[model samples]
Target: MAEKEAVEATVTGNDQQVGFRAMVMKQAIAYNLAGSARNDANEIVHFTLQGDKHRIDSALATLQEGTKRSSDIKIATTSAAIDPGLNAFTIVDWTSSSRNITNTYNLVFELRADDTAISPTDAKAAWHQILEKTLNADDLKKLQPND
Candidate 1:
């Protein structure tokens, strides 16, 4: 199915604060939200994201910590025509006097899982690569089994 192009995700909590912007940016980038965010005088964090539906959904889900404070987050959607030329989702600089971005959208292809791990060595290396790449994902941690 074809995915939507634009998403207006309004994250909650610390919206009136400056440091929270960094936290939101990190989480959004990890999930590949191509847009920008900044704190406004109305205490609302305005975010303009242009990306695939799955990536945008994933970013929104991450922002919802299930806490009371996080529940305040809200989002509104509409059909938008975007230039599908972006290489990847990114956080654009919002410091410019004009808060505008060269909007572009691209379908992010998922890597196939190495289910061909028929051997222990192969399985180890495949899993190792997955873990190593996840280093930048703060939301991801060392895998643990049910003790």
Candidate 2:
């Protein structure tokens, strides 16, 4: 049997709010890949896939060819170490969790609109708080300036 391979990809450009994740999930499932796909706050679609080398390559190729709703899709891919425990492909709903930054931001806005104790300044503070909690070490590195 051929050794399985893994890949991590970030797809940007007209790839959000247009069922891009669903499309990618469908392709991954069809290719018998195991992994997950989700959209980040910046509208980038991040995905990880593990499967036969040929099938992974084919899926990536299909993804680069944007869906009907997507335009000018750009994808960046990198080889990833395969996770032996991954069982099936899935689409993660990051925003549904209260811990998610997007959800926190939405809550802040809702509180402000409801004429609650949350003032405009409080909303801004909430935004910063959520941003800090949400950004991981990798995200912080990306935001750092070159010395």
Q: Please, what are the lDDT tens digits per residue for candidate 1 over residues 8-59?
A: 5565553432333433454444544455565456656666666557766665
Q: What is the TM-score of each candidate against the true structure?
A: 0.45, 0.62
What are the runs in model 1 whose C-alpha is more than 4 Å off? 1-4, 12-14, 66-71, 75-79, 83-147
**lDDT of model 1, residue 42:** 68
Please, what are the lDDT tens digits per residue for candidate 2 over residues 18-47? 657656665654556678887777768999
Residue 144 error for model 2, in Å?
Answer: 44
Residue 131 lDDT (model 2): 37
Best-fitting candidate, scored by lDDT: 2
Q: Which residue runs does candidate 2 get wrong by more than 4 Å?
A: 94-147
Error (Å) of candidate 1 at residue 77 is 4.6
Evaluate model 2: give its lDDT.
0.62
